[model samples]
Target: MESMEPGTVRPGGRTARVRTAVLQAAGDILAERGYSHLDLADIARRAGVGKTTVYRRWGTVTGLVADLLADMAEQSLPRTETGSLLGDLKANARLVQRTLADSRQGPLFKAVIAAATGEARTAEALRHFYDVRVDEWAPCVQQAIDRGEVPEGTDTHEVIRAVSAPLYYRLLAGGGRIDVAAADRAAEAAATAARAGVFLSEGRPR
Candidate 1:
C-alpha cells in the first residue's frame, strides 16, 4: 500500500500489480475519451481495484496521469547503436514515427499533449518524459563528434530533438503522414544539418 507520488516509482508485489492495472486503465480512458473524462473511481472500477486504494495512492487525476507518464518513460525502448550518425538517427526517427502512428499510442499521446496545454502538472510530467527520451538518444550525436563526423560544439541534444520534431508535427497537424518515408527524411535532414554545423554553438566551428 505505498502511496505513489508524481515522478516517483512503486516497487514490486501487490503494489506493482496495482500500479500496472491502474496505469493501463488510465491510458485506456485517455486514449478512448481524452483527459477530461478521467476519474479515479472509474479507473479503479476498470482496473478492478478498490476506489480507496486509487484515491490514497494517486490522490488526483493529474497525479495518476503523471505516474502513467513516468511509467511510459521507464518502459520506452532503448536507443539503437548503429555505429553511424545517419543510421542511429534513422533508427530514432523510425521509432518516433511508429509510436506516433500506432492506433493506441497515437491517440494516447494526443490526449496527453492536449491535457498538457491547460494542466501544469501534466505538462511538467510530459516535459520530464521527453527529457528522459532525449537523454537516452543524445549520446549518438556525441559519438559522431568523437569520430569527427560533426563539429566539436554541435548541440547533440538539439540534433536528437530535430530528428523527432517533424514526426511530432505530422502527428499534431492534420495535413501530413507519419510514415517511414517521412521518418527517413526527418532523420536525413537532422544528420545533414548536424554535419553542416547547423546545430553548433554560435561562433564555434561553423
Candidate 2:
C-alpha cells in the first residue's frame, strides 16, 4: 500500500489510514535503526512521505514518539471483565504478553526503552504510554473493588501497573521468559497484592 503524508487527510476524511501508516513506519525505523539514527528525513523517505510534511505534523523526534505512543494507546486491547480480579488480571497479562511477544512491537519497545534512557522527551513519551494503559486497565480494578474482591480505597492504578511490571521486567531486563506461566504469575502476584492491601490508602500499612 502506498503510504500517505503525515498530515494528509483521506478523501473519505478518515485519519486512520494516515495515522496507521505513519506509526507503522515509525515503528519500523525504531526497530531497525534504534533511536540515535532516527531522523525525520529518513523516516519520511522510508514512509514515502515528504520530509516537510512529517516535520510539519510531528515537529521533533519527541513529538513523533509521543504521537506514536498515543496511536498505540488507541489501539491497545480493551479491558476484559471476567467477574474476578484474577480473571481480569490474567486477561490483562495475556494482552501484555501478546503485545511484547509480537516480532515488531517487541523490538520497537526495546528501542523505545533504550531511547528513553538518554532522552528526556522519549522518557516522557514512554511515561505517557504507561499512563494511558494504566487508565485503560484501572476500570478492571475498580470492578474488582465493586465486587468486594479488593479493599475499598485500593489504588487501582497501582494494582494495574503491578500486573504489567514484571512482564515488562522480563522483556526489558531479560529476567525470565515472557510466557503464559509468567503471565499467570504476574496476575497472581497483583491479585495477592491487592488482597493484602498493598495498594491501599497512604496511611494504611501493608
Best by lDDT: 1
Q: Candidate 2's error at 188, in angstroms?
A: 0.7
Clashes of 1: 0
**Cα deviation of 67, candidate 2, in Å:** 1.0
lDDT of each: 0.89, 0.79
Would you estimate the TM-scores of all the predictions? 0.93, 0.88
- How big is the positional error of residue 186 in model 1, measured in Å on the Cα after superposition? 0.5
**What's the lDDT for residue 109 in model 1?**
91
lDDT by residue for model 1 (14-123), tens: 98989988998998899899999999999999999999999999999999999988888887878889999999999999888878887778888999999999999999
Give candidate 2 regions above 4 Å deviation.
1-16
Clashing pairs in 2: none
Residue 163 CA displacement from its true place in model 2, Å:
0.6
Report residue 165 deviation for candidate 2 (angstroms): 0.7
